[model samples]
Target: MEDSKKIIIVGAGLCGSLLALRLVQRGFKVELFEKRPDMRRKELDAGRSINLALSSRGLWALDRVGLKDRVLETCIPMKGRLVHPIDGDAFLSPYSGRADDHINSVSRPGLNALLLDVAELNDDIQIRFECSVQKVNLEQARVEGFDHKNNCSFSSQGAIVIGTDGAGSVVRRTLMARTPELLFNYSQDFLRHGYKELSILPDSNGGFKIAKNALHIWPRGHFMIIALPNLDASFTLTMFHPYESEIGFNNLKTKEQLKAFFEKYYADLLPYIPHYQEEYFSNPVGNLGTIKCYPWQAYGKCLIMGDASHAIVPFYGQGMNASFEDVREFDELMDVHGDDWDKLFTSFQDKRHKNTNAIADLAIDNFYEMRDRVDDIDFKEKRKLEMHLEQNYKEYYSKYSMVTFRPELPYEKAMILGRKQDEILLNMVRDKSQVVNVDRVLTKIKELHENMRNEI
Candidate 1:
């Protein structure tokens, strides 16, 4: 009976589906429940999925699941950020000095659907679409919810329950309900800024309106708009702005006002988006928030993973990548502890919580950097110095490179080293009176990493 017990996974989205496939591959039965209609058959969520930037960490996870090549076949690679400033000529900010170290732009719904499809191929995994799991009895490993179609409740018990239900997670809610007993620590920080999805249609010949290989950024001081390429030749644009400022989402209600605002800030962007007014009025503004919680595993029988355990803002483009990496990390723990859910869950969370928290903080830091710091004189010099170091020195990886390209390094360590490197580089770049030495800068970075202890 113990061996026959199934593993229940909540929310059959990206993380849940990939996780289910991995579980089944290890000869475990998985019941994956999703609340929404299967997107493979239905239309995607209207106007809000900013195209996901799939990088090394995410690719490593997919590779383990045997989907890396399949996924990559459909993804368009973005080499760097092309920053569009309001005052002058736009310039490209390379994500890395190396061309091979690029990020892929993948459709969120498309990727999720692919995961669901692959997950369903295995008989050991049973994915029920339109069924929502609202509560989990942590002690007993039981889940209770309904098939939203008929409004009928159902319950099941598993060897363990995994919550990958994302930001507003019901599994996480259950853990919160047991705060007194679990002493569960939790916090949510919502950004003052929010984002509304818009678009840049392809040219008449179905070609990309802008450079397809670059992630386009119209960076304003307080807010910014970002665009990523899609396979359809069109670009998925997200307008991230504050809710209460002069260029706030709440203030622009009419066409005239919206037109005036765009003309002032995004004049160059107008040619690509003739339907801006229509999309602006139609799409909803999504909130940007980070959710962090402690003791991701509950009672050795239930655990939370991905966005359910640690939700972060989309600024750093690591939300999905981090979630994918969660599966790889969990799988590694399973390799060591085989079939012992208790040890696996505890070990998994213990190693992961700090890393997740680091990325959350890093995402917030990137928000400000992208919004206000990208075009600064010192910042440009810093980037130029970093590019030179990266090209010549194989040992050197800028902060973004360390986090995005290095799958072997943990997020916590990457953040610690990256921040220190940034501070040093910034100081050096700011004081242009002295000549900069790439070898010396790399030596300092190496020393910092070597001297670092495991603070996480």
Candidate 2:
């Protein structure tokens, strides 16, 4: 018999779209709704991050939907971070020792459009665009929303509601309202810094203005500008700056002030973006914050996923990847508990929240690492040692590699082991008297991993 229990998903972005496709594959009818008009049809406002780093975890989820190879065709391989210091020559920091292990720079809309197209192919999925969800009936699995196109309000109910809405999720708001009864715990912590998107347009011949294969970062002490390559040959540049300081986004009110600030701090980057001032003034400043909450599922009738549940700062380039991982993990849970919504929802929220929390904390840790410590002598030495360890030992995976490249490893396990490995490696690099011994370091790491595994 066809599964009569319909899965209603709100927010037809990356997670929602993918989840809808997956649910259809599992023989469930899916009602996918989006607040915005379909990107495949209309040109929406350029959202927060134009491009995202798609790593192994995200690729794994795409593969589940048989869209991985197709998605890969649209992505530019970012082999590693190309660090450009203000005063020194630029350097390449390889993400991993393994040549095949690298992240891809994929346009957000391009990928989302592709996913939506694939989701639409399935007859079991019905997608509604421009359907802004106003309120959700948590216990009843019903959503009431305003339909912008029809200029009317509509209501729909499902066997269960799965919310894949982004950070500012209306579905999540509904859960918050019923917090006292559900014992829901939520916290949103914003970074002191915010980001503004700028661009380095393609060269005269429509060629890349900078290295097209690596993520470029011009890290300043208190702020940074990072650029990711687009298939169109232009680089999407983001300026992550404080909101209040003299050189901050808040303080750079006038064109002249922004020009002077760029000329002083980002002089090297100014050439690539001749229209920096215009782009800076034109783009909107986006806030960077982490959202954490408990009891992702309410009564096994409603659940929240993606940024809607665990939004994190973008420093680690894992927000989208983590959301994608959620789909993959949830799908795995479905395999075990087929249409048992109660067990599936309970087990998934209980198991996945810790892993999401680990990545949230790690993303914040990377904010400091990317902006303040990427150029530090100690950090450089530590990375060098990590690279060497990864190259020599087949068993060794750096913290970055474990998180970015190892899709099989849970984020919580990766965070724990990777942090321990990082401390050991950093301490090893700090000892000037000791010769850099690869075998000894590997032994120590192996022992540490073994101990951690046993303890856990």
Q: What's each prediction's TM-score? A: 0.96, 0.97
Q: lDDT values of the candidates?
A: 0.90, 0.90
Residue pairs in candidate 2 whose N, alpha carbon or C atoms collide under 3 angstroms = none
Stretches of candidate 1 off by over 4 Å are 1-4, 47-50, 432-443, 446-450, 453-456
Looking at model 2, report the run of 10 residues with the lowest lDDT sum: 1-10
Count of clashing pairs, candidate 1 = 0
Candidate 2 lDDT (Cα, 0 to 1): 0.90
For model 1, where is the 10-residue window of minimal lDDT?
447-456
Q: Summarize candidate 1's per-residue lDDT along 320-353 as a digit string, tens digits.
A: 8999999999998888998788898889999999
Candidate 1 Cα deviation (angstroms), residue 443: 4.9
